[model samples]
Target: MEIAENTALVVVDVQKGFEEAGFWGPRNNPGADDNIASLIDEWQSTGRPVVFVRHDSSKPQSPLRPGYVGNDFKDYVEQRRGKGAGRELLITKTVNSAFLGTPDLAAWLGAQGIAQVVLAGIQTNMCVETTARMGGNLGFDVLVAYDATYTFDLEGPFGWRRTADELARASAVSLHGGGFARVLTTREIVDAAG
Candidate 1:
């Protein structure tokens, strides 16, 4: 899993709402921050690329609605303020598809000549999955850092509770089996990045 110099790590919404004390708050994303930091460090050192995708929930009831406290990137990510400025890129969107709703992520990737994307973030079955599918459709080889993504339980159409772990694994299965992405553990990602 060698990371090319043109590779980019697409970090999706890891907002405060998904951390230890917000909407989907739970300490479930094992080694998420660490893995992200490791990858960030490697990418920064190598001058590759790191793109941060933030979800700006535009609806009033959504966790990231404007003026809401949970709208901001969580402490772990936000805490790295003032540093890594030019080395990283930040993009915001109001929908699940980071590529469709935001400034052309695909175009930007093409501009950078990026052929590979390593993904990590929260709400594994939602934004993360959506972006991976879009990235694959756009022809980027995608790798999802499994432990670096998390989600919450919800009552689906089946009337059963979908746990965080369940959704996470579901994303892995769907993305990996659907020819969209490869699901790799944090350790695998870190090693690859290194």
Candidate 2:
């Protein structure tokens, strides 16, 4: 899909916390971070708006809790944001949906007149999915980078175990079928951005 001039790249929850040992077990989309970083680079180079979302967990034991090393961004993201200055927007959340948290992401986007949003980051079934839903509901054109986000295998009710790949596909279907967003690959988003 061709991106509008008033588009923002939303990078969600790509923190060191998610990288904690076995915190997210057996995730798929191995090169998701590389794809996300590439998107950030492209956004920076093209002078498009870029928003970084971080999950600051309320659970004390969670690695994403404030003051923990895991709460900080991965080195690559940190470096990129450090140099971005006013071009980068950082939104922190303590909940599942970025739009539902303390920050008013939708309002910020509305203020910026961002009609289209490109999403990339971690936990395809969680933060990424929730944010996409909210963005869609708020009437923004939400494009998700399927390969640029990853999630761990999950143990569901009734003793059902879902692999990371299965969860990823589920996320895609939920958003696509629900008309919340259009799921695309990292390369597709990059090529379209070009």
Off by over 4 Å in 2: none
lDDT of 1: 0.78
Over 4 Å off, model 1 = 20-22, 25-27, 85-87
Task: Give the winner by lDDT.
Answer: 2
Task: Give me the overall lDDT of model 2.
Answer: 0.88
lDDT of 1 by residue, 107-190 (tens): 888887789988988778899899999999989999988887777776778788767777788889999999999899878877
lDDT of 2 by residue, 115-181 (tens): 8999999899989999999999999999999999999999989999999999999999999999999
TM agreement with the true structure for every prediction? 0.89, 0.96
For each candidate in the order shown, give its overall lDDT on alpha carbons: 0.78, 0.88
